[model samples]
Target: MAEVAIRGVHKSYNKVPTVHGVDLSIADGEFVVLLGPSGCGKSTLLRMIAGLEEITAGEIAIDGTVVNALEPRERGCAMVFQNYALYPHMTVAENIGYALKVAGTRKPERRARVAAVAQSLGIAELLDRKPGTLSGGQRQRVAIGRAMIREPKVFLFDEPLSNLDAKLRAQMRIEIRRLHQRLGVTSVFVTHDQVEAMTLADRLVVLNHGRIEQIGTPTEVYRRPASRFVAGFIGAPAMNFLTGTLAADGRIAIGSGAGTPVTIGVRPDEIQLLDAPLKGTLDFEIELVEELGTGQVFYGRSGEMEMTVMRNGGGEAALPRSGQRLFLKIPMTCVHLFEVESGRRIDLPPSRLAAE
Candidate 1:
């Protein structure tokens, strides 16, 4: 395993910068994920670390050695691409051992290594099958096995599960997590999927446009987002944002189109259907309710903004019909305040925002 250090890294095409100056340190054996929307430079950054993209400025070092000038193979890293880049005609065994063969390992040793990796990946029985004969998941495993056989110090996965079905993606995520735990290799994964980033990463580096938005453990980013962008991007059904003004008592006064003040931004799960706290209750018109097995998501329009509420299994039964008026209770603690102009979080004292 090796630590990767990126110092003031920058990249561009024809003088138009795509990756702004960025610095990040990845610890040895740490599973770090680069997460962002498309065109955010996450993949470009990964490719730069893999030595596939040339660095326009600054340095990339692996295990304390400067590798900006090194080739991809010499950087001691293996990259698994979005597309399963397997040789069509090559059998699984041949594909897995191809890199070893290229490095001139003896045929016997290569076969042994291939078999060991295949067994570890539970693909031993499929060794002789060609790529065309394998399922999507199996082909992906062969792609991963090929990388494993190289025994590189760093593993780079660029949206490796993007092509798989939902069920397969979930299963492969567990398998990948287990494999990483067993191998303990330094890994840099790039993905646009927030759930994958949340579940798989030891730490997530959130990127925006060509710069870093926030970097933290998944829990930290989820619970205490550094920016409104991070807050909205990291959550499912996303965090609700409503424009409001901070009042004298540190309370946020939401404004109606006609200038009436209302409270804003209590997460759906945090909003309870209750009778008390009349001041925090808002009338909502239920537009739809989705049943998701263990829970139901209530989609409604509160004033002018659309709001989503996640209820743990009982919401559907109690939810009102479309266009019906219902009171949604907002607990003060779950409300996140953001500056209307700057789109930055408002740091309110706990005492002021705390629930009574």
Candidate 2:
């Protein structure tokens, strides 16, 4: 296990900058996920860490050693790629022990090491099988085992589960987490999937347009996103942003009106759909409804703004139909405020004003 320090890292391709000055310190054994949308430079940053891409500027250190000048092999980092880059002709044992064989470790010792790693990955029985014969999850386990056999100081995963089915991805997540617990290896994962980022990361580094937007634990980032981009990107259905004005009484006056122009942000799940009329309730016209087995997601429009509402485990009678008009209450405590012009989050006490 080793700590990773990234200081003023920058990258560019043919004079076009892709990764700006990014500084992050990853503690030993911590699982850090770099999250963002496409073209956000997350993959570029990960590649730089693995020494697969050269840094245009700045320093990277592993276990207190500057590794900017070192090759990937010399940096003591093992990277697992998304494609499960295994040799089709080689058996699982050979693939897992390839590094050892290249280093000239005796076959007896290499086989022993491969056996142990495969056992840990719960694929000991498949040691003799080729990757083509294995299931996606099994192949992924082999890929992981190959990395594990290296016993590197840090583990780098570049969207390793993107190719798997949802169920297999979930299972691999558990396996990877369990492996990290057992080995205590410092790991860095890169992905655009917010769910994968939220569930796998000890802390998330939200990146956008080559810059670091926010760095925090999943809970902190979800509860208190540092910027409007983060608030919208981290949640499913995204955060609902309504153009509005902040009232003198600390309440938000949604829609065009006279007051301080601002933006109100709230998650879909945070909005309460009131069956009966209440003070300060806004009218929402449902346009579509998606059944999610245990819950429902309603997509609709309120006045001129479009929004989504999520309800968990509501009975059939409670489900609202498309074209239905409902009342929505935005709890002040769950409200997020942002500057309309800058898109930056603003701190405000919970509004005391209720539905007027």
Candidate 3:
């Protein structure tokens, strides 16, 4: 395991910068996930660390040594790409040991290493199968096993589970985390899926466009997003956004147009739908409802303002239905406010908001 340090890294194509000046540090044995939407430069940054892409300006040091000019093989990092990149003609065992064989590792020692990696990945029995015969998940495991066979100091994954189905992706996530635990190697994973980022990362580096947005533990980013983009992007079904101004009367003044606005964000789960209206409570016109087994999300509008409220299913309370008129109690403490102009979060005194 090794500590990976990135200092003021920048990358460009045709003089147009794709990765802005970015600095980050990965502790030894830490799993850091770079998460964002497509075209966010996360993969470019990961490739820079793997020596597949050149940094326009800045330093990438692996295990305390500068690796700016070093080749990929010399950086002591193993990468698992989004595509499995397995050789179709080779059996699982041959594919996993190819790196070692190319480097002139003795056949006996290489076979022993391959066997160990396969067993560790729970794919020992599949060693005889070719890539064509295996399932998507099995092929993915083979890709992982190949990377593991190298025993590199750092592990880099570029959306390694994107090729798998939903259930397989979920299963692979746990296995990847366990693999990191067993190997204790410095790992950097890039993904656009929030679920993957939340479940698999010790810390998350949220990126947008070509720059760093926010970097923190999953809870920190989810509970207290630094910006409106971070808040909206990090959550599922997206955080509900209501454009209005904080009025002097302690109410949000939402008009039809996007006027001078203060954006209010409400997590779906934090919204409470009451059967009767209470003082300070707002009205919601329920338009649709989705019950996704584990929970239910209510989609509706407040006047012209759209919102969603999430509630646990199979509960005692009657589920709110479409066409129903429900009063919403927006807990002040659970609400997030942002400056609409800059799309930056605005911190209001929680105690003060709660009291109002």
In order, the Cα lDDT scores of the candidates are: 0.86, 0.91, 0.90
| Candidate 2: segments with Cα more than 4 A from true spot | 247-249, 350-356
lDDT of 1 at 263: 31
Candidate 1 lDDT by residue in tens digits, 1-356: 89999999999989999999889999999999999999999999999999999999999999999999999999999989899999998999999999998899999999999999999999999999999999999999999999999989999999999999999999999999999999999999999999999999999999998899888999988887767788889887777776666666766556534332333455567777643337767777778977777877779887888888777866445655666667777676777766555555667788987734
Task: TM-score for candidate 2, please give it.
Answer: 0.96
Of candidate 1, the 10-residue stretch with the lowest lDDT total is: 256-265
TM-score of each: 0.94, 0.96, 0.94
- As a TM-score, model 1 comes out at 0.94
Query: Ranking under lDDT, best-scoring first?
Result: 2, 3, 1
- In candidate 3, what are the lDDT values of residues 148-242, reduced to their tens digit? 99999999999999988999899999999999998899999999999999999999999999789999999999998988999999887789887
TM-score of 3: 0.94
* lDDT accuracy of residue 222 in candidate 1: 86
RMSD of each: 2.6, 1.7, 2.4
| lDDT at 1, model 2 | 86
